[model samples]
Target: MNVSNLLKYCALSMAIGIAIVPNANAITPDDQLVIGMSMDNLLSLDPAAASGLDVVGVNSNLYDMLIELAPKDPSQISPAVAQSWTISDDGTRITFKLRDDVTFHSGNKLTAQDVAWSLQRVLKLNLALASTWKTYGFTADNVDQVVQAIDDYTLEITLPEITDPKLVLYTLGSSPSAFIVDRKEALKHEVDGDLAHTWLTTNVAGSGPFQLQNWRAKDRVLMNRFDDYWREPSEMKRIVMRHMTESQSLRLMLQRGDIDVAMGMSIPDIEALKQDSHIRTEANTRGTLYYVAVSMKDPKFANKKVREAVRYLIDYQGINESIMPNYGVLHQRPVKSGLPATLPGPGYALNVEKAKTLLAEAGYPEGFQTSIRVLSQLPFINIATNVQSTLAQAGINAEIITGTGNQVYGAMRERNFEMLVGRGGGGIEPHPHSSLRSLVYNPDNSDEAKLTNFQGWRTAFYSPDINSIIDTALLEKDAKKQIKMYQDVQNLYDTQIGAIFPISQMVDTVLIRSDVKHYEGHQAATTRLREVTKER
Candidate 1:
């Protein structure tokens, strides 16, 4: 269906009431516990438009997916709405059998139809949502069709082509692209497409364990336990999420016992938290990589030798030791640093002498000048300062520009900067296609397909051979073939197309009050309220 029709249907659906107000005294702070976090601020409450930590926090409380990552074992998926799933022989179809008992917080039964409708909504409203489908090598446009209601509990998903393991994993994660919303309820609210964007910006209704009760943007959000939650009931009756923008304020709140958990603290703050006996710290390897996306389109960086020289000049080891001493781990590959069989091979080895030679070969005997823009957020500022100092030692004159996240993202998208330092989150898929699509597949222009081509990366280095290898890897079902193809792509990325420099995938450290419990299964700073509980 066209987007206009979809919008009309959504508006009609939302007009019908889906929410059932809870008893006034059913939930209260006295019956629950509070958690604290540092949020980047949310642009919208709808999972489709969610990109920041605040948005994630809000969505995690309000929405539920068919499948969820098991808390103890992230690789072992578990049932949320869908109890079990089976793959077709050709791996082209995935059939998910929904749990019979699950219902939305609004009291409507969640069925196969809802699941199908949710996926369709994401596919239909692609731009309003995060660009996660790029990793699947299939945008929402590629979802050939979704058939459901085979007895209400069975949902069958038919893709245009064979499904890859990485795609499967991505579809089950907490990412915005995977969240399942109530179709009838969403439509009844008069929110369809972009119009629904504003409606969902601060309101929600879903099957997740927690239900949002209040949201004061840039301040705090309050959620209470969903009494009709299909699974085990949450331990805390309510959860208070205080958005303390300043790290110092968060630190003070934690010390005063005003909050139970504090997330995304700086290295120094984490170190200080360790001194308090009442606080406990947990760190996990984030599926994220910090890198400097250099503009290959620039005349100076167009040469492969120049790109290699820039990569070699980065002293990742020293930066980690000095800036992120306790929480950082050097990353060799774009994948997370701690995953099994995901390490970098000969392609990522560092060599200063080789860098100098490459620089000289690129006609930069004394290196060249470039501007590096960085987000003003903590840790990023420190990291950029370190990068500036390190590049200077290689005779490269680097200057740092600071701006807000939105400003930086816009600048990168507009190709206004020489280099941009940022992390490309959500590359959990093992295949190179997952990373390649984001960096290479530009829907707007075949020439500028890679998202990283933001800095005018149009060059002859866009190799058809590398693209073929990535495509083969995506279609390859066998694990061995996938790895080989991935290796080929990495080798190409490292040696030929010098678009990005791989930095450390540092651990995201979170501090929880000793009295709090049930916060587990976080691979990074990203947390799901469904899996967390506060001790009384």
Candidate 2:
């Protein structure tokens, strides 16, 4: 049979509505984009507090950063609200020249003060996104003094410590915390001294292409195109993001033309759709990693030999081949793949006998029982099941505990979990430090530090040596020396058997209608909808 005939045959066999009469729920093309994906991790819309890829995608359309990492080439920085910027010879200060033409959705003129205040709000609030700035030595006390507006269209930032100016620039262009908020509008709704923290949870004060019409938590988010946008208005008249958790439902909706885009679909469903002529799948590899982490607070896991045993228990080859297709590729390193500084993975493979011997050496010859906290979603649950099976071979009985993103990660944030199957580590910025900062560099190991932003801290895994290496690497001016220093950090991490073991590098796959034009998925999760349009 021809490809078209096969598609029809397959659709008819499945009795999908698209083969006959479309469902009433099917959306008709009206210059609007309808997307289906899970919103469980979308806890906060406030740029300072929002913590997941869902909110990052949402905020991309709702706010504009000073600069942007070009979607086409993330290595290249693209100007947005800021027209141009210059770094001081000492590499301690950066001055940005703002565009005079930009205005917020509230019709307030975008200015340097707005940029300064928006950045300051992050440190002042000290929320989830403040970790990055804090690492750069900016604090609530120093923020006002360092990040200031020299004039209405000129913003200046003085780094509180000696570090790469590019890191700060990358943070400004890519981090959601760097997105500029309308200072005047936010202050108008400020309750007490929150800087509109409460209001911004569900509202927006941005200069991006779309304005939030309504955001019903865990249900749907509706946004309309901002007609007075600085650039060409979004081709989409409105964007509707329906809160969908089921991959099967998303696949069905996409097959029936009910939604223009579907994210977070199951591998089987995604593979099934590849034959459908009307749909196409786009896979974008992000900087994040899917890792199996252990808390060092647990005496059993704190042992270096035990950590190595746990590493040997993972079936890296099997998982990447059978379980990680369309999800991720085998990457057994802290830093993500493809970066110039990122060394090849240590090439650790699953060796059940080796794990058994290591366990015996660690005085766990009979193995032990533990619990693994994992997100209750596709890829995660599947990966956990595989890990559980492999761990059982080494006599480690791990009870699988599943929950939503908030539940699983919240436990990790509280330093309350024994083991976890999770995905994290920054990939938004092109810099190698991005991943190391999130996954390896832990300045504080004490629980009192409450440095929940760093997964390294969350795992209670700290090496002063590793931290020092990272600090020195960031300040190194020579390109070759910096790369060598990063490699040395990874070598030390492997030798020390860090608490977190990378299994695979993340690859986000989304299915979209063939006619959905200009929908580019970003490695940073900041996929913009401004230029997206539907041919139908």
Candidate 3:
């Protein structure tokens, strides 16, 4: 299949649908972890082309980047393939000392040349992952010039004159684009100018703890431990990511011992699992967030007061405590809480009177009706329903339209929707400027721009002031002032009413059997299976 068809095939399969029950005859070894959940976001296995927090989690196990984030402390950087790195005082150049023992799954000894090649390929391909690296000032024509290998053990990266050096490392360590692949293995399979995309769509070409053993689209992704991995080998020799979408099937599989771990279960199912003696459920607050977007193209929402009123229409406490229990927290800022440069906004309170008054001031005293598109999956559909009800209480009618992610989110991306309740957050690097870019930065709304990275663009919202704040903060040298710039951006967002982040969510409730051990979620919502072992 071609590239576009391949993406459509994957998207069609991952689109929210009926849950397929796992075959009962399947058996797992004592050292194997058969995880059950809907693998929806994993489109391409190629490190250069793939994107998403789930994709990051899977690719992290397959490819070893020069650096990695300290699991517990996202603010701190840790070495992965590169033992150490140094930045130039000017904050424009960085040099990494690559590890000598690292070897690709293809049995090729990793060289600094390979590291340079992998990064350059991201620029050459210009896929979704490319945004991670492209955010730094390197372009396809100049990436080769910007990225160079000092020697077989040393790789160097040169940045723009005004770029923040820390942002480079944070982007390299956390973004999917940084996952280094085997230089030669990928080219060996290159076809039709695809840069090995056709082959890599389902193959593994990295040096992580686990290697891709098999991938049956819409069914399961089977990965096996890489014995020659540079780090300690995973205790579980294999992991099976079962393609089960329904929360009930996941809960059922966990109860019957069909799957060792069940992730992404609904709130009610998660609560019921707590009562089950055989199941152990863990809920960790992650960097993921849920927010509402008002299309600026819509005349009603174009009014700032109407947008602010919509924010107050949401019952943050009632929604989280009752409908989306443990899914998210009451956070309304553009950035995740506790991150540097993150400043709290005058959070929208649930008050029908307040909403009605704002509506009246916006010249909609009797209120109006609008359509909201959402994914027909757990939590989102439920959350949309709750939002609909709340808006109705304020005399505003919100009709809910449910569809697959491709239909709902794809529409949002194409700028074809008036309003949407979307899930997004990029706080994995602990930077407010970076996270806000995903939520509110829209330098251009032109079709030719196609700047999907900026969610604000999707909602037809654009502001030169906020966009300048994002650009300035990213390149700001002084840490304190950079944070102040971010604070200014948040304050601008509060008054302008571009988007409303009702809450930041934890994202998952993982159910594991008592035998399961050491399973924890990364801030990006990807579960690392290497440290996971069973009591047996």
Model 2 accuracy (lDDT, Cα): 0.89
lDDT head-to-head 2 vs 3, winner: 2
lDDT, candidate 1, at 73: 49
lDDT (C-alpha) at residue 96 in model 1? 83
Q: Please, what are the lDDT tens digits per residue for candidate 1 over residues 312-377?
A: 777777766776654557765644544333546344444667777888888988988898888776
- Report the number of clashing residue pairs per model: 12, 0, 1
The models' CA-based lDDT, in order, is 0.63, 0.89, 0.77
Candidate 2: which stretches are off by over 4 Å? 1-27
**Order of the predicted models by lDDT, top scorer first:** 2, 3, 1
User: How does candidate 3 fare on TM-score?
Assistant: 0.88
**Model 1: lowest-lDDT 10 consecutive positions:** 17-26
TM-score of each: 0.83, 0.94, 0.88
Worst 10 residues of 2 by lDDT: 12-21
Shift of residue 358 alpha carbon in model 2, Å: 1.9
Highest lDDT scorer:
2
Question: What value of lDDT does candidate 1 attain over all alpha carbons?
Answer: 0.63
Tens-digit lDDT track of model 2 for 410-483: 99999999999999987777778899999998998987877778999999999999999999999888999999
Q: Which lDDT value does model 3 have at 203?
A: 90
Per-residue lDDT of model 3, residues 30-83, tens digit only: 777877766665667788767655567677777888987776677788888899
